[model samples]
Target: MGHQYGKKGEELVFWNSQKQAVVSNWIDVEDHKFEPPALELISELLTKPRNGLAPDLAVVAKAEAQLAKVLDVYEARLAEFKYLAADNYTIADVLHLPNLQALMETPAKKLIESRARVSAWCSEILARPAWAKVVEMKLKAHA
Candidate 1:
């Protein structure tokens, strides 16, 4: 599946005995095509400085600017629709679950929380019982 659909395939897939694989690749492409740049920017902002050197404030600012632009795009779309693709939940929203969960604990949390609709969407998704079980399992495993 990964070879066939790349990272999007690796993210989420539904397969049945009929050999049909319902994939999220198209939704991923349409919804997240502009995300790599924001991801790269976040990576640059979060990576530690090496060799006892100080973090570059200028570079961090640039990355924040880039991320802000990406967030603006998301905010606009989310204002109109409850989810990325439509009003209903789908693989498109599911694909973002983990990343958004992680970001909630990071410096970039505001990227999601600052937008009203995006924040509401995240709250609704994160409140699901399945996600709560996943978090519980992760905590128990670490303990």
Candidate 2:
């Protein structure tokens, strides 16, 4: 794949040049400000447990605390708007889908479910066809 790009067909180099085109369409770094914290929550709660072991209880507890804080903010906004970034679905909502889906497998999901607004937001976004397709693709990949 690297060779397909040219002499120095490094995947990183190729990705660096093309990623902006794709990412710009999905997220506007200036406007959709929720991505960073959302990403942090995912990293702390989801990715950190991928070391072939269950998540550390202390770590999960701390992440859940952080998640509650994050949800508090979203919960307030969700009362007025339909999505995290705005009234319409945006990258801010999309960013949470996969990690939230993964979280559904864990006991920590109660952090989301306990918040009415946040739970509604999750239900709406997770029900999208695009997200469903992503889940399908992931299942097929594992299969």
Candidate 3:
């Protein structure tokens, strides 16, 4: 992932101004609208080592277990309710999809596949035109 502290993603995904002295002086620290999702993702991906492609087996198992707890929470909530936070998409969905897909490659896949709404949520995100395009490009690039 190589997502070090200073780097630029595409304009839409990040605003990496490098925090140069001049640029830092000109920007208002509190005037930001959205903190970049790609920055967050990059941080997460970098922290995990190898974009988490080589996660420790125990770590993956533990994460799967931790996420099972979350899925249970969401599933229980959805048994009588609907989506997480809102019924429509938001930045959370965008941030989460990559991880969910990654986890789906591990033990969490069984849990996600078995959960009805979670499965539907995964399907919805993966099915979107833009999201699919991004996935296709990332996959084609083998990132």
TM-scores, all candidates, are: 0.63, 0.65, 0.54
In order, the Cα lDDT scores of the candidates are 0.61, 0.63, 0.50
Question: Least lDDT summed over 10 consecutive residues: which range in candidate 1?
Answer: 13-22
Give the Cα error of residue 89 in candidate 1, in Å.
Answer: 0.5
| Poorly placed runs, candidate 1 (over 4 Å) | 1-26, 29-60
* lDDT (tens digit, per residue) of candidate 3 on 1-143: 21242244322212344423323321221113112322233333444565555435554455456556666665774565344433434333455566655554544467678989878777777677877888799999986
TM-score of 2: 0.65
Task: Please list the residue runs of candidate 2 whose C-alpha ends up more than 4 Å from where it truly belongs after superposition.
Answer: 1-54
Per-residue lDDT of model 1, residues 65-84, tens digit only: 76667667667877877766
* Deviation of model 3 at 34, angstroms: 20
Leading candidate by TM-score: 2
> What is the C-alpha RMSD, rounded to one decimal, of candidate 2?
9.2
lDDT of 3: 0.50
